[model samples]
Target: MITHIVLFKLKDGIDRDTKQVAEAVAYAREVGHQVPELVDWRVGWNTVDRDISYDFAAIGVLADLPALQRYQENDFHRLAIEKWRLISDWVVADLEDQ
Candidate 1:
């Protein structure tokens, strides 16, 4: 299995209100549920670590490279990536078993 984690730093001047943040997080979570290749998903808004420069983060789990590839190629993921890119800066890391 692999853990694919991403962090986002939203652009300047975007609203960070609770409702707005909640909506974004909800959308992020929804992506995984809609995509079969994603084993799990978790999205979080930057709260305690405001100075770290990222506004949001997501963690996704996949059983293997093929699963990850499928997730990447999915239309839903493409849309999510487009939407996310419009609002934030992002980073990703993929972890695997030894």
Candidate 2:
């Protein structure tokens, strides 16, 4: 299996408690539940506060690279990512779950 992970940092002046951010979070969570290629999904805000910490995280476990690609191409995944794209900067990593 492969683990796909993303971390997000909120843009300057963005407030996580606001309606927009909350809605984005809800939508992202739905994608976690709905994406077919993902064997497991987890997405949420980071629990710690520190200069080096990102504000949010999304993690997905899939069968392999093609499955990971399908997860990325899923429509809901695109929409959920667009929501955060407007409000934050993000980074990703993919790992082999051996």
Candidate 2 residue pairs in clash (backbone atoms < 3 Å): none
Q: In candidate 2, which residue ranges exceed 4 Å CA deviation?
A: none
- The clash count for each model shown is 0, 0
lDDT, residue 63, candidate 1: 94
The whole-model C-alpha lDDT of candidate 2 against the native structure comes to 0.90
TM-score for candidate 1, residues paired by index: 0.85
Residue-level lDDT of model 2, residues 36-61, one tens digit each, is 99898898889999999999998889
Write one digit per residue (lDDT tens) for candidate 1, span 1-98: 98999988877876666455555666787887888988888887767754766778889999999998998898877877877766677889999966
> Which stretches in model 1 have alpha-carbon errors above 4 Å?
18-24
Model 1 scores what on Cα lDDT? 0.79
Q: What are the lDDT figures for the candidates, one per model? A: 0.79, 0.90
Among these predicted structures, which one has the highest TM-score? 2
